[model samples]
Target: MLIRQLEYLVALGREQHFGRAAAVCYVSQPALSAAIRKLENELDVTIVLRGRRFEGFTDEGRRVVGWAHRILAERDALLADLDRMRNGLRATVRIGAIPTAVPATPLMSSLFSTRYPLARVRIESLSSREISRRLAEFELDAGVTYLDNDTPPGTRSVELYRERYRLLVPADDELARESVVEWAAAAALPHCALMSTMRNRRVLDANMAAAGATLVPVVETDTVGALYAHIATRRLASIVAHTWLHAFGVPEGMCVRPLAEVRPRPAVGLIVSDREPTSIVVDALVDALSGADLSEALERSLPPVIPG
Candidate 1:
């Protein structure tokens, strides 16, 4: 029997009405009925209960419906497996990363390419929350996000590096001369910027509050790029994770300093679903990220910024 007929049977079982099932399947009721009849004839079994209206499947049909689901799932897996072998390492490895982790993408990409030599990687900017959701849905093969705090359930994690917060300000700013800025002192500065959705911001906020001050960011943005851009224009001073500077070139006449008060720096890492299988390309990317020395790689890939 045709797979379409099997699909029609499964839809009929779910919808429990010919009209509704046909509507879901985007076909006329008669067409669905005819397909089911053909299927029954080929199998030489009474698959459906006949009545004035559509009814539930027969016992034989019910068993067959279960088999159909399994069969279809296997069919899809087969196709994916065949495609992978045929294409070698050329398949797209869809990845999601937090704003702070954006800078680390190219180094990871370069290392992955050196290993696979043929794989193509697509990296998307995503928040930690969205990254977990996409991974659960199997839309993303892997994601780069906070390793400990924001990670969701049932995912394999790979620790990459610890991201320490640092201050980015104009070179001529009053606070620039200090070896390090206290969280309390930085909050009192004019025009401080924050990334509203990031866990990094939450950490900064908590640190500032602990230091007997609360942040009142003159600029709040979703992306670190925007925060950096504003700092470049001399509009704001921002507390940024060290990883971001690895990705983007800093503006002229800017300075950076480690935030001494915010101790026990947070860790950043990769997360992949435990339920979903990692494609070859994804494995290569993971190997590259886990195997390389991120601090040294960042130094080589990125222009020198004021060291934190």
Candidate 2:
């Protein structure tokens, strides 16, 4: 019924715990529960399944939650439109980015901020699948993720760059002497890499397979920082996106080399919902990035690999 009720419902659906949902909505548990009960009474449908705790949403509740997502998104868009009419753009643009794409978000955000100084940008490091899911659910305004593979449906994108792979090794390592490293050779080293669940790791696996190699990482982690830590300590080498080097530079005691085999690199870009009456913040972000030659800019900024 009320917008606040819908907000509480959406938060409950996302958190799946009464206390957590109440905390997110900035209300007491009893207040949030009363709002949901009032909503259910008005709709004449059982929205949530109940037990000692938050069990799950009913089938009808699932549909309601889906509609709630759109409604809240539209409400935000309306506010953004009015703000833009009176002042400059002044809305928070929530973005979910795959870890490999995380490094490149600043390139997009910096451009967005320069144009719309009042607008806020929030970035989250998420898996590719999560980015796709959140965008479809209106939880994310846009995403920075691989555009060439498993792109979310009903969305359009502006390709920023094609991501290339590189091998990272300690300066004292044997492979560090080479100007370029083959995938098979990189695979043979004691490797630390992203977890197999990540799309980036899957991409690396496919490339290595094409090169007659297989990745058997000595350690697997979800974060790039952990991978870098292993390589920096000379405990392991890693195959990582060139964007990582461009963003963070080579870790101390480590050097990067180009991969010898040139496979078709995946395009990483900004993706937003393609439906009519899109979010104004999303539109502003796309406009900010559409004309910029980010690929060239990132290439120019890529840190030089230290000599062996």
Candidate 3:
């Protein structure tokens, strides 16, 4: 039926309640419900669950919602194509990135903003698995994350930089005087580590295992701020990506040294959906980043950590 009905259906699926869905669609609940009824009548199938309160969708309704997502996404892409043909590219590009890439998002946002001044951009920090899942669901335009043998299908990747490891040790620590440290030495220290819940941590685990080393962190945190806080103690150290140092200066009393023994470094890159008919906005953003000054974005020199 009407595209508006499909829009309502998709919104309903997203918000999972009639009132909130109507609010998102900028319509009253009654009107939105009537539109859904009409859509079901036209399609000759029951698409919405009939209930006094918000209930889960029926199996068929779920399938319709999936189709609705694809339809609305393609429709928006078509509109973006037309708008770019007549005018310049002007549409919101929502990007999702892993926590490790959060510091790098502004580079992409600024580039997009400069190229298409009128276009809107949003970058959200997410887990790598979440990024890949959202990309497949058409919820994200692109993502920045580690790419390895396990990279998900239906993605077009552009390598940005290799993620190198650095050991952040207190200035007075035994290993602080060294310009470089072996993984075995770093693994033995009482350190703060990113929680294993993250794919980044998993990658680190695999790399350390390969080096015959293991991390037995004194503190584990999900956020960088927390991890940094734990590292404030001269008794603790952390092995982190050098890329992260560009965002947060090294903690107080900490000195960074490259890891001399992690044989291969994992690459971090930008990944977009490989849909057959790619979105115009995705293409434009990729083109903008094609000649990106990655060196600046990849800056990893450790700053002198002042005592806090």
Candidate No. with top TM-score: 2
State the lDDT of candidate 1 residue by residue for 1-308, as single tens digits.
78788778878876889999999999999999999999888888888998898667789987777677555544544565577688756656789988778887777778777877776788999888889866654557799888775579888888777776667777788788788788888887765565656677887877887899988888787777778778888657777766776666556777776667556767778887765344454565677777567766654644444533
Output the TM-score of candidate 1: 0.71
Query: Among these predicted structures, which one has the highest lDDT?
Result: 2
User: Candidate 1: which stretches are off by over 4 Å?
Assistant: 1-87, 276-278, 299-308
TM-score of each: 0.71, 0.94, 0.88
Give lDDT for model 3: 0.81
After superposition on all CA atoms, what RMSD does each candidate show versus the true structure? 7.5, 1.6, 3.0
* Model 3: ten consecutive residues of lowest lDDT: 299-308
Clashes of each: 0, 0, 0
The regions of model 2 sitting more than 4 angstroms off are: 305-308
How high is the CA lDDT of each candidate model?
0.74, 0.88, 0.81
Candidate 3 ranges with C-alpha deviation above 4 Å: 50-52, 232-235, 291-297, 300-308
**Pairs in steric clash, model 2:** none
By TM-score rank, best first, the candidates go 2, 3, 1
